[model samples]
Target: MTTQTDLIQYLLRLGDSALIQGQRLCQWCGRAPALEEELALMNVGLDLVGQARNWLDYAAELLDDGRDADHLAFRRDERAYRNLLLVEQPNGDYAVTMLKQFFYDAWHLEVLQGLSRSSDERIAGIAAKAVKEATYHLRRSGEWVERLGDGTEESHQRMLDAIPLLWRFTIELISGDDSETRLHAAGLVPDAAQIASAWQARVEQVFTRATLPLPAAPSYFYLDARRGLHSEHLGTLLAEMQFLPRAYPDATW
Candidate 1:
């Protein structure tokens, strides 16, 4: 049986991924490679933030606690966060950011599609709406992946280098934990192994067209249990993102 605790945790994981990823993209303010790219990332980042709010709001309901989406986003300890190591990775360069988004958005699309069929109404509703957004996100990021990988020598080489480094994190995105497993068995979540296969196909299909070398094999760095573990970067990101809320708990517009 999938307990409410399990559902809340899973929802937190979903929300955290979006919130953290959104913060990462927001970092590109006036920093993207071009004006158009800057605007694109910004809009995409905002979209993720919006998605986070929906997930977190439902998480709050399942929690049956007083905290809301804002609290979950701003008040949680670093250890409580469930975002993937991939989303939390530093946006090293344009290549790094786009590849990361491509990988995540691709997986997100499949997951959302599965979630759209969830037995739970709120979960299903959120997933149904999110699937459309994830589809667009995947397309945008995938387009950039092809462009960078097949572009100029300098751009192509940069993307080539980014692939190996980013590949390690991809493993974790499709691999779920006990919480996810229970929910999945209850038909509250998707089959991660199945999704893993689809994710691989889509990712490989894109890489094939871009003529980029595919990353191979099991990654030790993905860390089998991601529930309570995170990279060093997440803490620094939280400090900045949570600053306003933490410093002024009562502030409002």
Candidate 2:
């Protein structure tokens, strides 16, 4: 990004989102509605984790700190995390999870599209690789949202009910703060406001295809998640994800 601090934080935000989403997806491995879905979720989870490693390792290199990807992923407390609120939210039902995935995948693809053209060659390369995986994610989630929203009575209602609650957090994804503003000006990242337009267009297209109504003007009353602010759920999630690392310091697989 613009500076060491900016790049570090940006990478943390990127890597953390992928790590948390990967873990959340894994939670559905045994619980998905069907065997195919179960396998699909796990595969996507692995993809996210791989992305996390690439981002975090490069972040650690920038830091020149003793920390590695595992340390950043496991040793840090909840408050130290910079993942988006959309990702850290608990996955409710299948429809809820799919809608959340669709939202994130849409945003992820846009972010990668911008980053793929970045002046920073490393970031651009990573974004190039990630774009392929993210495209698959958006396709998978988008199809599921359409299917569930237009499917039988119960599935449609589930999607309808899940949208509003999760919709609030999507705003933060597109409303980057001062840090992002600086980075955007330096050509390190895309302007979220501009990216927001692209994100909205994609979301609207998917929603229309799904027969789901779009929120006319959804309010963003949630915390400023870009700067490490998080919901209560992150604490519990970190407690488990960090337990082994904290308990057995310097442990290796």
Candidate 3:
């Protein structure tokens, strides 16, 4: 029942989330708490950007509308973005950053693990390569969550404070819209319910170790990113990210 248009939109969701999340991580390059941590964050950001390019490349090809990956990433307005709401949120304190990354990394790994078996070979190949990087990302972020959550009183309190701010956005992580359902039914993507179950289990396991309390339930604000709705932060982010390309549309890199 799914058409190529559905597939293109689904790919955009994956590509956009990686692109925005990578940009958020890069914002910490000069401000990370330590040099070593800064380098790690940059490396992770680059990995996500690379993955974004791969997904966007395929999406561009499917569209056949003369736009390349760069165009799709840099030319789109905020309302056209399909990234998850969690990634668009501003990077708060280090604790908030780590928790946000942990939440996303957890869901990302589940989705990529399922996509590794995608009916489309290109998708499967991309997912297979991304799985290695995502596995490392999740492990690194999960460790940070534990270190800060269980470390000192101040760090522990910060982690606790971050939970409520970031938890609500997590509703999007386990839930999929109609496009995803169509793909899954066609065996082109993973089952949404299965992805949700795995993501939730991983989150619960990590939270238990960090001694962090899990939100009783996930909630969302008025917007849904899957439907081309996004947080206000995304508009600011896109303005900065897209400035050069828009200003010099004819310029070649």
Top-scoring candidate (lDDT): 3
- Residue-wise lDDT of candidate 3 within 1-253, one digit each (tens)? 3479899988999999999999999999889999999999999999999999999999999999999999999998888899999999999999999999999999999999999999999999999999999999999999999999889999999999999888989999888878888898777899988988998998889888889888786865789987888877999999888999999999986
Structural similarity to truth (TM-score) of each candidate:
0.96, 0.96, 0.98
lDDT of each: 0.88, 0.89, 0.93
Q: Which ten residues in a row have the lowest lDDT in candidate 3?
A: 212-221
- Any idea what lDDT model 1 has? 0.88
What's the C-alpha lDDT at position 35 in model 3? Answer: 99
Off by over 4 Å in 3: none
Report the number of backbone clashes for model 2: 0
- Candidate 1 — which residues are off by over 4 angstroms? 222-225
What tens-digit string does per-residue lDDT give for candidate 2 at 1-253? 4477887899999999999999999989779999999999999999999999999999999989799998899988887899989888899999999999999999999999999988889999999999999999999999999999999999999999999879988887667777878888888888879888888999999899889999975566747666568998888888877888899996779
TM-score of 1: 0.96
Model 2 residue runs over 4 Å out of place are none
lDDT measured at residue 215 in model 1 versus the true structure, 0 to 100: 72
> Count of backbone clashes for each model?
0, 0, 0
